[model samples]
Target chain A: MNPAAPRPAEPSASAQAVTELLERSRALTTPALRAAVGRLAPPMDTVAAYHFGWIDADGRPTEADSGKAVRPALALLSAEAAGAAAEVGVPGAVAVELVHNFSLLHDDLMDGDEQRRHRDTVWKVHGPAQAILVGDALFALAGELILAAGDDATAARAARRLAAASRQLIDGQAQDIAFEHRERVSVDECLTMEGNKTGALLACAASIGAVLGGADERLADALDTYGRHLGLAFQAVDDLLGIWGDPRSTGKLTWSDLRQRKKSLPVVAAMAADGPAAGRLTALLTADAKKSREEFEDFDEAEFAARAALIEEAGGRQWTADEARRQYDTAVGALAGVELPAATRERLTALADFVVVRSK
Target chain B: MNPAAPRPAEPSASAQAVTELLERSRALTTPALRAAVGRLAPPMDTVAAYHFGWIDADGRPTEADSGKAVRPALALLSAEAAGAAAEVGVPGAVAVELVHNFSLLHDDLMDGDEQRRHRDTVWKVHGPAQAILVGDALFALAGELILAAGDDATAARAARRLAAASRQLIDGQAQDIAFEHRERVSVDECLTMEGNKTGALLACAASIGAVLGGADERLADALDTYGRHLGLAFQAVDDLLGIWGDPRSTGKLTWSDLRQRKKSLPVVAAMAADGPAAGRLTALLTADAKKSREEFEDFDEAEFAARAALIEEAGGRQWTADEARRQYDTAVGALAGVELPAATRERLTALADFVVVRSK
Candidate 1:
């Protein structure tokens, strides 16, 4: 049930392709990347090192448990799907991964949660000020990395897209902080916020692949849309699993969204309720500190179960997940439209499936 | 009496050229930079507007303050000193000025400052998160701005110098922060820290200009040293004025550093307790809250007289100002060493003098 173990795709041909796709990503992040990453700013040198599991908390070299480089994998796969090889996307892949890690470090701090990827969050270990600077340094380095790629035109366009994405992300983060103070959350409202928070960078990731793969603006835009959909689906599924899945399996505590009063998709959807469970949940939440941790825990246990039922009843969760799956499928389908090698197309489709079906 | 009025300079031929040199920096910024700042990211867009006084607290457009654009002036002047025309250093000028403002915004926030350039600080209105983000966006834009410049090699070199200086500045800031937690200070420590905190960027300003102006690396390095000296001198003079000058003339609260217990140059120099004044001052600071505002105000009323007497006793203020002037002259002399048009050389010399003598 642990999400950390490397998963094998089924014995089917598609599964073998996905396994190869994953391997391609892993292989592409070769020894040269370690040398390249060494040239990054010290702030990121440390943060990236830690995030990649090159070193443990005491600065010792544990070199274990960095998350699957999913974004980079997608980038490489998309490049292959566009008929270019993985080498074309390698530099851009590193940049995309740096951006992804940068987001994780900052978002973890902003959200005030402790754990990330089965370890203490950067802020928990480094403190917020250092963590914030680390994130900033990483962000700067990410843009710099993108700027360092191939030709004048390619690097310039990539840098522009990356900078625009970075700005949108800051705006999205501002909205999230604002969200904490508001009383009501609508489905559409959170959707836009989620899109900015998650969708923007994913879109950029896809665009980067297309750009490196030599796709034109039209195809890049399509890839961008594909990435956007994939990101939305990824976050929605993540939110779903957070409140329902086994902690041991997901490596995240269940009912954490409700316990933390996080403005997640289901929570926002559940707030629109007008029935018995809704009243009970609202009164329980509003009733205050008189509610014991045991009581609150008990409430969350039943409430999330009811909330899951309510999500189904409202057609909200199903629709969102369906939309997410649709995006995933479309993202995979978009590969077919681009001129690509058969092996590359097959691998990309499998990677897309592997992303959604990820238990963690 | 107007803070805006130009300070009188020595009537040398070089001095006569100063006004025109200063004017050229303004020429570089206004129309050209008007379009540039408009395109910055939000936290940065708002900040670029704020630093330039194009917008107010509510994000509404207001009259622009046109901050003398000193950093840009320094850069362009360095280029001029090195025989490069205005067009040659335009991007460096804009980029350095932007960086200068970025640092100012962050420094003001951490210092709990409420005002800047006779206007409310960005953080005083937009809050710290936005302020932090604004500084960050400016940093990003600063890097991007370099790319839009003279040639690929020059742009790359400027970026390298800038990014390196940025790391040094952060290190300096961290050291400055460390100085606060430990209740000790000395003249040497103050000078080095201030050199890093303020002087580094000022030095970079001149260096960027020189590099862009096609000054040789050795000459650029010399200008950097010269600029650092000027920066230190400028800061020392500013500290003196901050404590004793008329608020109307300085556009800052009298004894502002004393009131805030800021570890400014004079305070650092005086911490050696060269006389009874140092001891009494230290006692007053440590027991600051116990003192009546009237007592502090009376000390303020007597500050110019007290500071003059104490500085004379310690030979502190005179030594610092003399040291500053020495550096300023050295910086200007480096430009003289460069082959230059006599008039352009004169303007740079004049600009150096202007930097030391400006009231606000």
Candidate 2:
């Protein structure tokens, strides 16, 4: 659990191979995303460009970090798994990335998150109305990209998959918001919400590429299952980091999730632990609720530290870490059922490691 | 300009014909829209059902009036003009209606409108965040509806048209929001904004049906032009009613546009008049600005009445009325070269008249 603890090293050959593939995937897909977004009219286009960190607020082009392009990498890999060239799946990759960013844009506005990636969010800079519309434009563009992909049946099939994922994503988002108002949220509900929020799009990303690459329905389903488990693992690991990871490395505030009282996996797991730690955690949260909203903003640093320590002591930290590993193994096992090229299978396995391990 | 005044009568035959067609179109398309929306997951689907007035807040099925389904009628008519069966355009009709409602859901939230159609807005009934997500789900469903229609080529083309229109719609909405902060907005600018906001979707509805019905590119373009002109006429007439028409019939507050200081067509025309009446209107509006936000909410009825009188005196009311009729004529004229059936042409013409001459 300690940050400085040593971890086992990955087999160097596959690790370097996947790293190369990921970089190459980004190289091909970033331009495709830019082209897709360029189809939008100004101000929305400009807002999107700013949100993607391709430009400054004033519309001047700037070279800034966009993101990991993880969804696109998964998409390209899935295409390769289907025995097709990755270029054939560029449209699918773009759609998945756009949907991911669309969710981020709306989530930032809805959550009133002023800063993302150490910069002002689109809503914060351009205002909520513009942010809302630009998000809609990106969503529309994502659908359009898939609809325009290739032949009719394939494009329609791909769009259908994307649409279903989008609906689930929205449903998941609504549930998450609704859950905030409830007095008690069960672990099952939390997991289902996570599946909808984080897992649906990733599953779509994984399967859509395969579908477009001419994979049969069963193989695409397998990949979707793999991605779903991978998404759960990724969220689990993220929850662990929220509690115990170094703020300097994570680029977030200390105990950021606790400060916001986010019902993340670790927090939920600890709440359901039924131990004295859960009792203390509940009392602390309830007492914190009596504070005014402004008081919550200036949450006590020592209280947050205490809460994190309690969650760790309740075994939530360990449980979630183990769950992440379990999901990661299951995800990797999913790839074995499909007849993929040896290189593709190795890359996928390495990508699974990259998601769960977090330690380089 | 008075609400109680009588208007010129429409030819009974065409009016009856178009009315029957609109009813038939709604009968065919409403079920399809409901079915499409039903495909979305619960909670999102429930919110959408509430938005469509199909259900109440308690999730009980209720007999509520949906809107006029004007976009669907236009779609069906365009298909008929293209020598296709109305049934062939049902998917396009459903898609347009979905997109229209999507805009309404978002617009209501953005504008903080509390009521619509004598019922609470979705955001008021549920929550803003839920309303936003439901709007998104509906939007995704709209694209999926088109993509999954009948054949690949037609569906893709229709989806592309809808996507382009959606972008313009967002642009129009952004401009409308931005215009609220401006000291002066030109009539031309107002028209363009309305074109993007109102006309774009209507134009897409008109053309997409024809395109899906196998109309040639030129014919589809003609229908699009017709719908754009008709949308402008519709908005112009609606603007006139916003100030001078009876709130009882309009289902809005008295002098609603003036109360909100909305730069509707009449307001922009009066602002650009450069006459004594315009000067008086400016002085009154400037004085209104001195009032606090709460004071604006408690605006004096006499002051609103005086603003309306000043706009009418500045020739704004008459200019907009004439413009609406002029646009209606131009829209009807657009059908002249399309070689539509005489009955279809008459119905389209009658629909144009109905848009501009909204006596009720």
What's the lDDT for residue B158 in model 2? 77
Among these predicted structures, which one has the highest lDDT?
2
DockQ of 2: 0.50
In candidate 1, the residue pairs with backbone N, CA or C atoms under 3 Å apart (3 or more residues apart, or in different chains) clash, namely none
Q: Candidate 2 on B208-312: residue-level lDDT in tens?
A: 888889888899989998999899888888888888778778888889888888989888888789789999987777677567768898868987888899998
Looking at model 2, the pairs that clash are: none
Q: Across residues A27-139, which tens digit of lDDT does each residue of candidate 1 receive?
A: 88645456655755445566557766788877888857666666777777656656687777777777777666666776776576698778888878866655555555566
lDDT for each residue of candidate 1 in B76-187, tens digit (9 for 90 to 100)? 7777766777677778877777666667766776656788878888877776666666666566567667765666566656665665566556556655755665566777
| Each candidate structure's count of clashing pairs | 0, 0
DockQ comparisons of all candidates to the true complex: 0.18, 0.50
- Model 2 spans > 4 angstroms off: A1-22, A35-42, A56-64, A79-85, A210-219, A270-315, B1-9, B39-42, B55-64, B79-85, B210-219, B271-310, B339-342
lDDT of each: 0.67, 0.82
Q: Residue A65 of candidate 1: its Cα lDDT?
A: 64
Is model 2 an incorrect, acceptable, medium or high docking prediction?
Answer: medium
TM-score of chain A of each: 0.85, 0.95
